[model samples]
Target: MKILICLSNVPDTTTKAKFVNDNTAFDTTGVQWIINPWDELALTRAIELKTDAANTIENITVITVGGKDAEPTMRKALAIGADDAVRIDVEPKDAYFVAAQIAEYLKSNPFDLIFSGIESADYNGSAVGGMVAEFLNAPSVSAVSGLNIEGGQVKITRDIDGGQEEVSVEMPAVLTVQKGIAKEPMIAAMRGIMMARKKPLNVVAPVEVEALTEIVNFEMPQPKPACKMIEPENVKELVDLLQNEAKVI
Candidate 1:
């Protein structure tokens, strides 16, 4: 069984976000890029699944919709254990266009299981995975926390309303995973990093797909208010402040 993991290149979580071009574009200066955290966990689980000699997993491939700048993240994924990587040669404009490009690729090259993170760290859109599944007319499971292939059966444990639900879906399905998919993302070893240079990173041109939405502007949230300190003797004052200024009570 061949597995395809959809990767997203995002600014590291620790990087300070900055906007430019009159708040119309993200500032890329001195930013470190990495694979989306959730996607990294998905890739880790994919590698773990392939480790079992019984699963008969053929190969693992990572795919992304991005231009040349995204190759570094893809290479990091290869170092994590993907057999190869594919990048659609285009800047991802929006969720729909990105999903369409992936779906277009899937039409020509099929895989038994397709894994996508529930959302991208930068945008947190949470829309691409379901959109890709819709484009392919395939079933999809979202918010998956547990996944395993046992005796050729695909088992998924996902979060539901107030509880968890276990499901088994057919092949050629998409799974959008959240946290807990794996204990933690696998770090690439020195040997794996050297081997990643030899792994194939395929670049394909994107098909024509108009983005459904446009970014008008990006507005940052207002800065948080300073916390006021209170002493043990100021309990009444604190209560007064909470009731009047804070307005919680």
Candidate 2:
């Protein structure tokens, strides 16, 4: 079995987001790029499944849709433990474009299992996984919290309203994994880093696909109001503030 995991390069969570070009594009200056947190967990789970003693997986490849500037993030993914990497050379304009590009690649190279995070940290538009599945005409499971192979069958566990549901899926299926898929992300060890230096990172040209959406402008959220503190003795004032200002009471 082979696994393909999708990765998205995103700004570090601590970085203050800013936009430029008249607030039409993101400002990448002085920003630290990291793998999407959810995607990292999916990659971690893929590595764990591969390293198991009774593993049946043969290769684990990570793919991303980005420009040359995104290679560093892809390298980090390889260092953490993917067997190889594939880059679809294009700026990921939106969920639709990205899903289309990756699906185009899968036309020639197929994998038994494909893992996509529930959403990208930057966009949080949980749509790519299902789009890929639709494009490939393959079965998919969403909100997947658990995934494993038993008796050569793919089993998936998902959280429901009152309980969890488990089901077995056939191969060549897509799974959109959420938080509980892995405990922690796999850190790149020194030896893994050295080995990653030799791992192939193949770059593929993206096919022509008209972008379905366009960003008109970027807007920053309004600043939060300052906190007001009142003495514990001022019970009446606190109640008045809650009722009038905070609107809680």
Predicted candidate 2 versus true structure: per-residue lDDT over 142-177, tens digit per residue: 888988887668878977778889978877999999
Candidate 2 residue 183 C-alpha distance from true site, Å: 0.6
Query: How high is each candidate's TM-score?
Result: 0.96, 0.94
Counting clashing residue pairs in each candidate, in order, gives: 0, 0
Clashing pairs in 2: none
Lowest lDDT 10-residue stretch of candidate 2: 151-160
List model 1 lDDT by residue over 1-249, tens digit each.
999999999999999888999999999999999999999999999999999979889999999999899999999999989999999999999999999999999999999999999999998899998999999999999999999999987899999979999999988899999998999899999999999999999999999999999999899899988989999998999999999998999
Residue 43, model 2, lDDT:
95
Report how far off residue 20 is in candidate 2 (Å). Answer: 0.7
What are the root-mean-square deviations of the candidates from the true structure over C-alphas? 1.4, 1.8
Q: Which residue runs of candidate 1 sit more than 4 Å off their true CA positions?
A: 232-240, 243-245
